[model samples]
Target chain A: MKKEKGKELVAGLFSLLPIILAISIFLLLLTKAFPLLSLKSLPTILFSSAWQPQKGQFGLWPFILGTIWVTITAFILAAPLSILTAIYISDYASGRLKKWLVPVIDLLAGLPSVIYGMWGILLIVPLVGKYLAPLFGTYSSGYCILTAGIVLAVMILPTIVNVSVEVLSAVPADLKEAALALGATRLEVVRFIVLKKSRPGVAAACVLGLSRAFGETLAVMMVVGNVPLTPTSLFSPAYPLPALLANNYGEMLSIPGYEAALNLAAVVLLFMVIIFSLAARLYLNKLEQRID
Target chain B: MGSRQKSTDRRLRRRHRAEAGFKLILLASIILVAIILSIILVTILWKSLPALKLSMILQTPGTGYYLGKKGGILNAIVGSLEVSLGATLIALVIALPTVIYLNTYLKRKSFLAEVIRLSLDVLWGIPSIVYGVFGFLLMLMLHLRASLLAGMITIALVELPILSRALDETIRLVPAELKEASYALGGNRWQTSTRVVLRQALPGLITSILIALGRGLGDGASVLFTAGYTDRITTSLFQPVATLPLAIFFQLNSPFPEVQERAFASAAILTLLILIISLLTRYFGRKLSRHKVR
Candidate 1:
């Protein structure tokens, strides 16, 4: 046992080296970059409304608002459709059909985000411009929050459906049988027993979906019109934090402290994602506990 | 009595139709997503039709659109292949050991494992643009200019979270009985891990690697600052390299139609590559799981 323990210790130390190195490098970079800008300046940089790089004024409020708007729009559009579809697939579809449909969802989820962005650029934006924008107003840019939100919804649908379906499918067979034996209809059983049991998982799925929507950069950047202003309407041009960083980093090289500010923005975004995913993990843990 | 029974049957038939309607809507959702994907594919092909001639694939990028003389995306394709493969290899080397450590020696340290898992999840959630900024700063600090080496290292960092989680999950999925049997034979922990658990998890690990490769190959923004675009292919890892996705991004904003068409063609190629890898990984993963069951 002692020899086995020694071998295990050696193997463990070896395995941890790479992860430790990667994390330390990231943290070291963060530390080096942080002192360039004062902590007192961070709030204005983050919360102030204006962002003119030429004037050396940078406020992240508009970008934050854009991110929140697009993500919320995506969730609102995707959540109901995803939940309804998950319910139908889990409770109503035949076993054979479910088997085939499940893989399609998986495939959609696995497709890289860049491809989705390309598709949005080549097809969806033009179609929206040609058809949908005419109804809104002549001044409306075709690639606006609506276009991005719709594409984001499509991108996040598979994730939501996959998780919700798994949760709904795991609703105890005995509960369903008991409901039916009590003379409750199939729809009633689904409405009450299955959904109630799977609520946490479904909620977790929605949070995960929101997380993806918020973090999505490539597709939204391609179609978001990327104006650095707070959007007053769905058709107004805007910029999210990710897009702002991506679009300006190359040209901002001559601007003093722009790089450090961008890094701070990134750090903030990373913190938000950490909080979101931690909430999701906690929800999933609670669901698992309930299941046990 | 006969009339009452007939009414009951009709009511049952109507209820069944409503259930069928719900199913139809669900199926329609799937079809809708598929149609959108197909439309994107068709649009790319349509846009790139002018550049679909054989020479476009074989020739190099040069000045002037010489109709049939316009060179192919040879350099961009080769560069993508090199950088993506290089990054995947690096990520695998890093991820494999981390996964093994988490699954075995650190298994008892649930708190630490949870923290690691949470960090990885957050890492995956962080936007690619953030990675670009981080990479640029790190490279500047290290005195490494914008080069393939910087880009590859950045991509490897971005991919580590997913790859590690995949490896960890697959390692955990290895049957406890297998490890116990190895231990009974007087095999050490390293022996059990490398010989038994790793062998069992190889297929899943390969799937994870392929997924990471697909992500790296399709990445654009993260490498934009780290690896500036270069048309001429170079052998040195410390030089600029043009990749397919970056080519697409650059071409989209270009004034030239030919360049834009080439971008579409490149995007088409990337989309198909990712789709193919995704399908193959899913197939192999299923096969491996089935093998385990037997």
Candidate 2:
């Protein structure tokens, strides 16, 4: 029995060996490429305004600004729609409506980002340039921050709706019923009882949606115009970090510090995603604790 | 009293109208999302119609935009199949044992299980582009060029978290009584997991694999840097090959109509394949849920 127990422990440790090795190798490479941990390059890399790699200029402000703008724009457009749809499905919709709506939402989630990019290219660019851009301003380029933001909003809608529906559905039935019994209207119950109860979950959903938008590459790449400069307006051309990395990395294979710069951008993107997910995870954990 | 009663009635009616307005807005939002999705699909199909030909699928990468119609995408199709399948196989191999160990041997270790879950969550949250860069750097270090093996490994890393989480959830749903029965009959831990728990979770496991497969097939950016696009099919795992998405990515930006049309047709085919896989997995997921209920 003792020998068998020893073998099991060894096997268990062996299972973890691959992940540990991968993580270590990643960290080692990152540290070697950017030895600026001792020189305080992170703040300059993140907060500086310029990002020209030709003359050793490496400011991430434009990339950061573009990423934030696109994600916030997407969130503003998608959140209310997704939340409303979730409310409809959970409260007002019948079984038939739910059946159709749920599958459609899932199918949306399953569609590849490339398809979204293709749609943006063949459909959105032309329509926006010819019609919507004129209405916005003569300053509008058909493929700008706003166009990419709108497409990203559509891409992230299903994620928000799915999470929001799960959260709203899990709201305690008794709380909602009690509100209804106290002469509260259905809207009041939804606003006060259900929404308030599921606040953490809704927040988690929003953060998750934001993370997805932030990390999105293909869809945004196709529509964002790929100009590596700060934008003056929603209609102005802009380049996001992911798009820059995707477009330039392959060509920069032999260029000194180019691969490093791409890796740094990736590290930044990873950090942003991790922060959002970590916040969401913590919020969910707190919610679970409260329920417990 | 009559006036007061009338005022209350009026207020209630106004509130009802507001509620109805809210519902209308909610319904409109759902309909709008659906319309957008349909428009995207319709637009893609409509635009790609001019390029829909058997030759496009059977031709190789041609020299000129118009004269390049000689070779079909048979090679790219085969390449995608092989790489994606290879990645799926590797992911399943890695995830299955980890999930089995967690669910069976380490069931009592709740802290460890939570840590694993948290790590997996973080892994999933990490963007595919980052995985691409990571894989690229690793390939450089290992001297593994942009080959199918490198691409498969990168995809395996991306798909690992999803497969493991799905497997873990499915394994957890297996009734404790079944494991207890197996143990009572003098079966060992491995035997119990393989014979009893896994047998019960087979449908769910299959669903997980299908989801992973779909995800692998859909991914393009992760493989872009790792699997440098090739025009011809090669049997060796270390050779470079093109995938459908990669082909679309490269071709869509070209000014030629033929190239653009081919991109559209390829996009449609990829979308159809993914949709079919997604539906099948969902069906299996529902089946597994029903079995659990009983």
Candidate 3:
């Protein structure tokens, strides 16, 4: 009885570790960020694009907008491709084909973002600068929002594809068979029955992709020119929140109020990511219910 | 009636063609993704050729290496291994116990378990750069210097969720009857958990640890400020240390061709390290799964 009781006590203490860590991280970010809130109004901090920190202007609009632009552009590129890939794998691919494809996708997902950054610099940037930008009539050095978005798309594609594949596979086989029995073609069954049934899971996949793309640092930071600007074109230079925080925090430590501003940026980034992930979870819950 | 039948036949033909075309397009996308991945690997390997000599791995980084000078990345490699290994160890201490608590001690639908799962999901989504900033704040508050120790602590926080979640899923997969059998044999909860559960979950636990290790090794943002960079390798936890990701980042930014070559070389080295770790994991997983009942 004593041993059992001791085991329970130990287990209880260890289980508190995650809760404590989560709460402490939240508190740390909040405490650091609250001071900046007192110093500046929320609207000013969020809306103005003028961010000359040396002259005391600490607006975050440019970074936030940059983040949104890059994330959206990546999503636009990745969603269709990943969804189609998932559909092919789940509904059409032969067993042998799938055996080869699944491992490749998994490896792509596991590849580090730093490696992606390297590839962007060596391949995508130059390709864009030399070939693609001319077709669009834009003069790009290639270290721009477009390059970052493309790399980010590739980095996050596997997440969407992996989730979508699992979701589509979980769809009841009877539903597709029923549609076929009603004189529906293969395409119709897939489009009208399977795709419709897996909509919630697909939405969750897209949101999860968005969350990951929004927070990616090393790859986007390396590809996107770290210039603080409101992006005017896909080829225009801009800085996202993660890049800005990473580039400036080392210097910001010595300056008054600067570190607080960086912390505030992190706070914003954290909240946005958390919100997206929660929404994804909510969709996943709905998907589970439908499956049941 | 003849005209209507003809129109329906035309529509069927067009729909069939469309299906074929869409399948081709989907196939093209998969091929495109594969092509891009291969091209990345090829380009890095090709560009790294100039600096891929044997001595690069053997010797420490030379002075002025960042200024387009020729040198090696040995220091950064050692530093990254030490920090990631240390962080993985720390994360294991917390993750293993928590996973056991969740699987063996609590009901599956318990409120605390749900909350932990939710919070872990949130933590998994939080960016590594945010972890870096948080670590910076921690160091400042404690009046401690940025060192290898700080980086390990920060990375442990970053990796804990991933490791715990992976192990939790594995534990959840353990059959109820097997666990019940242990209970029937008069095994206490701890004994059942450690002896039966851990034995069954060994392969998965190793995989999770390797995954966390791979993630920890590849990350640059979280360690950027916490582990201050150095040209020389040090084993002391209090001392600042260099890392491969930072080495690649700083080197690639320099305007010198030679320095840029070193950057590509370092990238290749990092990629090779990750590949080796993954291959080892695969081998280990296959070998160990023979003993795993499920």
Candidate 4:
């Protein structure tokens, strides 16, 4: 009996590890970043575009704006297509196509971000610089906000599609069949019953996709020409928070206040990711539990 | 009556046409996605074809390797494998017990389990860069340099949530009757978890681990700061290690066209590794029958 109690205690302690980790991560970043908050007002750091770290001006608005532009663009591009693909796979696709799609999407989702980054550099960058930008009456050097958005949209497609498909699949078939028997067209049945029922679930899927885009590092870093300025146009280069951290975290030791500034950026990114992901996770969890 | 019937027919025709049109659009989206996936694969293959040599895998980068001169990426390949494998081992050791504890010692849907699950989900969603920064700060406090060991521990943190959440899903599928039967046979919680639940969820456990391993192997940002890149392969725990993603990253940034071409080749190798892991996952996932005796 004593042995059993010990085993339980051991396992229980391990279970608390996740909570402990979460708190430590939050506290460590917040504390390291607290000095910067004290030194610089929150509004100035968040709103100013001036980012000369050496001159004691450490505005992060450009990076924050860049993250927003890229993520929103990716979200706009991915959300509808993900829903359409999910609908097709769960409803319209034939057996053969369905069989192929599950694995193909799995492959897309599994391919590393580095591969996507390479693809961004190799294909999207050139396409944007040479063709798309010019069509829009502008010239880009190929590394720009739009290119990053395109790459990110492709990268996050599988993540959204997989979840959306599951959400769509879980819609009770009986409801659809009943709607069909009432003389509803197939699309009407889907749009009215399936889509209606899965709205919140699909919204959660898109939110999770947004969180994913906001946090993506290497792929966005590669294509998003890391110039520290607010992105005025899609063809302009921009820097994002994750890229800022990845690019400057190691070399910032020589500059005073730079480490704290970077830590604050990480904290900002942490908040963004946690807020979006937690909302989606809780909503999805509730939906699943209700069903169960 | 004739006019009314004709109007109703027109409405039906429009609705049917609308249905057909909408379905076609949806079909087109799926087709576009497939084409893009194919294009990505083909592009990687085509770009790397010239640089894909057997020696590329067998040898390390030599002097002036970045100058488009001589050598391969064996250092990165080994380093990536070592870090990911190491992280996987550590995560599994910790995660399996946490999962067992959740499913057995705690009541289903207990408040503690709910909080644990929620926290892990949030951790899983936290960007890898935050983990990188966290690990870097920890290393600073300990006066440790960027190295393979630091990378492993950092990645292990990233993998922990992934492993636990995924394994949680798999273990949840184990029927309650099995546990009840184990207890009926005089098995305690430990015996049921080890002797029964472990046996039941092995395939799924492996599958979840593979998924986490794939994430760890392919991840670049979390280890970017914790494990600074190196051209030379070292078995020492304290020495900086190279990885496939960073190798591709650095090589692609090279001015030399030859070096740039090698970047594509590196991307292809990384993609191939992940592809194999995904395939293994599919195989094991299929083997993970939802109910053993239903």
Best by lDDT: 4
TM-score of 3: 0.95
Worst 10 residues of 2 chain B by lDDT: B63-72
User: Between 2 and 4, whose lDDT is larger?
Assistant: 4
What does candidate 3's lDDT look like per residue over A119-204, in tens digits? 99888899888888999998999998999999999999999999899899998898888888987777887889888988878989
Worst 10 residues of 3 chain B by lDDT: B285-294
Q: Which residue pairs show backbone clashes in model 2?
A: B57-B73, B58-B72, B59-B71, B59-B72, B60-B71, B60-B72
Give the per-residue Cα lDDT of candidate 2 at A50.
82
Task: Please tell me how candidate 4 rates in CAPRI terms.
Answer: high
- List ranges where model 1 is wrong by over 4 Å: A1-11, A14-40, A181-183, A285-292, B1-21, B65-69
- Candidate No. with top DockQ: 4
Worst 10 residues of 2 chain A by lDDT: A31-40
Q: Write the per-residue lDDT of candidate 3 for residues B1-294, one digit (tens) a residue.
A: 999999999998998887888888888988888897788889999999988987678778777777756568899999999999999999999888888888888886799877777777778888899899888889988887889999998889889888987788778777888899999999999999999989887887888899899889889999888999998887799999888898889888888888888888988999888887777667666656577555
**Root-mean-square deviation per candidate:** 3.2, 2.5, 2.0, 1.2
Q: Candidates ranked by lDDT, best first?
A: 4, 3, 2, 1
Off by over 4 Å in 3: A180-183, A285-292, B1-8, B68-70, B284-294
The lDDT for every candidate, in the order shown, is 0.77, 0.80, 0.86, 0.91
DockQ value of candidate 3: 0.66
Candidate 2 lDDT score at position B150:
94
Better of 2 and 3 by lDDT: 3
Measured against the true two-chain complex, the DockQ scores of the candidates, in the order shown, are 0.45, 0.54, 0.66, 0.85
